[model samples]
Target: MRRHILPPVTRPILLLFALAALAGCGPTAEPAKAAADEHGAAVDEFERGPHRGRLLRSGDFSVEVSIFEEGVPPEFHVYAYRKDKPVNPRELTLTMELTRLDGRVDRFSFAPQGEFLRGAGEVREPHSFDVKVRALEGGRAHQWAYAAYEGRTTITSEAARAGGVTVETAGSIVMAELVDMAGRIEITPEGQADVRAWYPGRVMALNAELGQTVRKGQVLARVESSHSLQTYSIPAPLSGVVIAKNSNVGDVAGGEALFVIADPTKLHAEFFVYPRDAERVRAGQRVEVRTLSGDNRVVAPVEAIVPTADIASQTLMAHVHLPPGASATFRPGMGVEGSFQVAAWPTALAVRTKALQRFRDFTVVFARVGNTYEVRMLELGRQTPEWTEVLGGLEPGTQYVTDGAFLIRADIEKSGASHDH
Candidate 1:
């Protein structure tokens, strides 16, 4: 009975004390909770200065950009701004680009730069954006967005370009190549029936006309001399079409050709070369001839190049041998072009004809630097339809555009870029 009576006062006092302690704890936590809620809240505010990046001339041929943040992470976000213009989603290629910069390099890629190179084109951008900086080291991250001044952030890269012809090269170069040449059939200088007339002084008559067909030893006309009254008919020297006939029946005959018939079976090409090219010319050299008729390219071997040059033309004549029974399409006096292999250069650096751009005295090419194109001046030597021998100005292992050189030039010109081409 005594314990029960004393516990009553203590129990009531303990309950009151507990209630007061709980009330104090509730208010104390309110300030801390309010601070935490405000700490991570989204804010609407503005900042001054160039907190964003704007890409300028991307080196000589492309565009690159950098933000004002030190120790930027590998996975930083990039925002593009274009003075309120919407961005082009198709042109963006961050996923396809090949990253080459080492970890130490501040440069980073955000688009698929390689796919654009599949065609002949180029890319130029002006936009502003916001991005998140993903920390790769410890997974720490931060986010930011910039309005980017009226014109901020630009990226330039190379794209595939279409090919175009160089008009100036047409007239300066041989319009076409000639591969074969042959002489017309020949006959006696006079219309003589005599089986044998070896002397230079012989008068002859003729009955054949230009383009007339004649047979070997067939009497075409008669030959008469002042000493004798024997009239002999001039026979066809060989079976061929008469290409040229200088005399007709009853005409006074001189040692000059009365009828020139070429042996169709025996054909050869004769080309004239300048004195400089004649030095490199030799008998038995391989040559390619392009006939003016129907783009004919005939390959033949050089037979002879006379040591003498034509006094009037100042040209060295070279005879080229052809295959027997050639197509009749090739005729005498047809213009043809020829090519000769001068020498070989082992390990010679070369590129396709389309890869070159002709300047005043030098040649230029677009050299790939990273994802951009750089103008490279090249020293050129011998050239062919398919390739050009590079004497200098390009590396052996580098890749270059072969088919779309003109498109690249067009892009550079359109952009008002400084280039040698």
Candidate 2:
């Protein structure tokens, strides 16, 4: 159903337009012919009533079809006249049907309202459809059929693919408030271990070397006690890769660590928060962490916020834990980027942000039904890079063009189609 007020929008016009904007864009259908009458003759007359509505005639019975959409959803107002004389709305029975591209039919029956007949249902958007009207008056039957289109274009399957046209369904989404910050990957102090000999002595044999992976309690080195002249085995304190080795074979191990082991998997990303974002950023908020090259990404909550500012940059820091399995790709000291979710809002109706485009004075998206794509004007609310809240002008479950929408708009403009009564 119609959601907001719009101007005269439905007009049957050119269908076939150039796909010249892209290379190898396949064949398109030919331009459509004019709307035909009940006798199958091309209707070529252009008649407008005093209300600026379309005028159709069958003998002495004529009806003016107009849409009233000032401050409400679109509704049809039919003014009946017999030989230029106003006919009481009660004297006629009128019904209209609109067949849309997707094979859905909308029927509206007219009832007496003031001096004219008002439709029982709303006239929805895009307004591109085949219209049929039947009127009964004074024991006579009158029929008129025509095509009305606005913001519509047709394309074949191959053309759509070659033009990079993509479609996605519109639905509910949660809008996030993001704060971008520069960051780096690091290993926490708990991830590192220092191995030391129990007694001051000369290292007789070194079992573990730098850059070697070792298990907890694994023999790291053997040392001889200088005090008692007894030999002892030095073991690794934690299971990790040996990052540092000080005392080696034949070297004196006197009050010094011999090996340093660090768990590469225990990592966190530190993001620098500026003064402006200090109030909004806090621990426990969700953060989107990505590598410098943007090839890898992960979502995790902020592990904690450093209470003190960096001595060099004077910026606050937010730490987000990296997945344990991510150590193979993300490493210590590697530069990264993190987007902190400072706030969020949930919405029931939303569309892809990438699908939105400018149409006239409105922001619109191309809605798809079979091979036809038409513009859907939107009233917007909160917006993010991913989705935007749809305040009006769209229905749930509608498929919309998310990519190559520019191609559709270009064709409609090149074919000279516009909002027309």
Candidate 3:
């Protein structure tokens, strides 16, 4: 994915990546203290504390809170100050509530740890949420609430469709395990013809030239039998191009091959399979053949597998006969690539690998509910280049972004939302 964070002035912000960007927490809000609280709100520039955490200030009393997650599960760390001087952490009773996008609230209580107060519960990943803080100092109570958002953005459905944003339902998919090999196109044995005279004779008149296209029974040469002293016409054996000419006029034609004809339309691709993979390759298996540049492609079944291995390379050859229609682009001796489907594994739930995006420390995809989308952190299992098994996190039939997901992420980032504490 392109990391180039496009500037918002260009209207680069798109809602397609709606949920995949929810890793940051931003802004303070809701003046009345919420008994229970959660794009996301924007703050000009959050005030920072000496510890580099978001600062919650109110006159002579303030609390600077940070998520301490260096080598342990994320936990909240808070430092309190009174009249611009350090205050005893033990003298204050601190508590907080984090309201997530789905209306789930996680509550925490704090205990003093040296100079900082450590919260009891883990903050969890993708710190994006709305947080409320309540601190009891002597006879006074200070309450603060704010909204934090990252990796979350929204745009109208019409705009999303116009921008070419596409989505797909996450469901069961059979993963194809492919064995890729390199080979070259070749003329099948039945497609080639080695011409010879019917009897011992001398080439009286060799008519066919190298590369001449000839049809079956077309007279290619006239030979004079050594014994009969009579001329006999040697017609073509097949309809194809004359690729090799062993004898011409006035040359002996009986003892050697007169010509070699090859039909380009009857061709096959031969792929070398090493011993480890040779056992898995069998006749009747489908194989995808493509030119080295991948401009042309064809799917054909394996027609044969050589019983013998190459003496030098110790590799068996798998032959896939190309269809007659592929002759236009598939030529003998042209290097090609073969992707043989060797095995397959089915999983109940899976998502397009391309749809997955980076969200903080987890792999996530945006889930859509009506016109809105949000992130779902996934627990991945087996994987293939095209699809990945979803063991946990995403639900069956959830809609996910397939194409233009990065554009969404770029738009959200352009909003200056930071999920990092």
Candidate 4:
């Protein structure tokens, strides 16, 4: 405002001050610094430190951490390097805190080995955890924290519901160790009959058709004796369905079967047990008979173990007697599946077979605690078609995902939350 012209030195100083004021009014420097602070230690994805482990650097010294499991328990090995040169193993004391996905934390101390430091305790699978490594260097501690992801994931309850995930609790179950075998629906000896021609016949009139229901003593056909030329009646021996018609009208009938009848309601299941299973199977054992459709199942007790074995298949026969009301849906000669309960025991912990998922090299089931799902490694025992006994790794009363577990696995895999080293 003073119409007076300033000196060159004063003008340059004023211009400098104006530029500084504009710079101060611009974006604050705090955001950039905050971002840098938030991402504390950077992960060198492309560069692995010595010992082929993850490298964490402080000043010119770097610590390489890896899990080594050769001829020893799984343990962490830490190697210290300075400017690509090996640092004295005695110079650093390493400790690690592994926080697992199940909210459990395991702490490990490392002592100096020949050339590096090794963790004192074992590291349990599946190796997915939030790992914090602290090295005591020159009486001062340097820390690095990162996540070692394995088979793990987290999903909200609403999301799981929308994804069709269902949960079931792990609990005690009586699982029968079953032996699978091929079987067929057969007619009991008393329930089957072969209607024969009473005399040699030159001509006959057939009255029964295949699959026809007939009453006991019902005339199935009329046969004429060749010697006397007299007609005789061929009656059904049992009240049941005619399964086989051996004679046609005007055909010669000898002393052979004219009709075969079987009572469907008196069916039995006959299973062929191989030598491997024959010793375990015995009379009075429980057997479940299922049709090829798999929708029908009948529980019956084993009636007998036939002494004869099949010459070609080398399998022994086991007979299961179906009760009168139990064979309504079964018919003779129908192919069936027999699951013999060879062994049975009460398990303290068991889960649905559908709940199991293969994660890494171990079998895992997703257990739901609150809104989060954590992977549970399973040590399996006897397994049935519907249930699997859990020998260890899962506790009773733990709620596990039974359906859509693979969907959760897919979600975790898609999120890239997987274990790497």
Q: Which rank order by TM-score, best down to worst?
A: 2, 3, 4, 1
Q: Top model by TM-score, which number?
A: 2
RMSD (Cα, Å) for all candidates, in order, is: 25.6, 9.0, 8.4, 16.5
Model 1 stretches with alpha carbons more than 4 Å out = 1-135, 139-209, 217-235, 244-259, 264-267, 290-297, 309-315, 322-330, 334-337, 346-349, 357-386, 389-404, 411-421
CA lDDT of each prediction against the hidden true structure: 0.43, 0.79, 0.78, 0.74
- Evaluated with lDDT, which candidate comes out highest? 2
Candidate 2 versus the native: TM-score? Answer: 0.80
The lDDT, on a scale of 0 to 1, for candidate 3 is: 0.78
lDDT, model 2, position 195: 89
Candidate 4 lDDT for residue 56 = 66
TM-score of 4: 0.57
lDDT of 2: 0.79
Task: Give per-residue CA lDDT, model 2, range 48-163, as digits (tens).
Answer: 67787766667667788888888987899999988868899999999999887667899999999998999998888766677777888887777777666767777775667767
Q: Write the per-residue lDDT of candidate 1 for residues 1-421, one digit (tens) a residue.
A: 0111111110010000000111111122101111111322212122111323222111111112233223631232333223323233234432212121111112234542331212112211111122212111112122222221111111133123112211111112222222233232212222222223333224465566777778887776666754565665667766777777666555566666777776655666777777767677778877776665436666777877878888997887788776654446455556666676544344357766656875324477665534344455677766766567676766665556554455555544433332100
What TM-score would each prediction reach against the true structure? 0.42, 0.80, 0.65, 0.57
Which residue pairs show collisions in model 3?
A: 21-150, 21-151, 22-151, 24-419, 25-148, 26-147, 26-148, 26-149, 28-146, 29-146
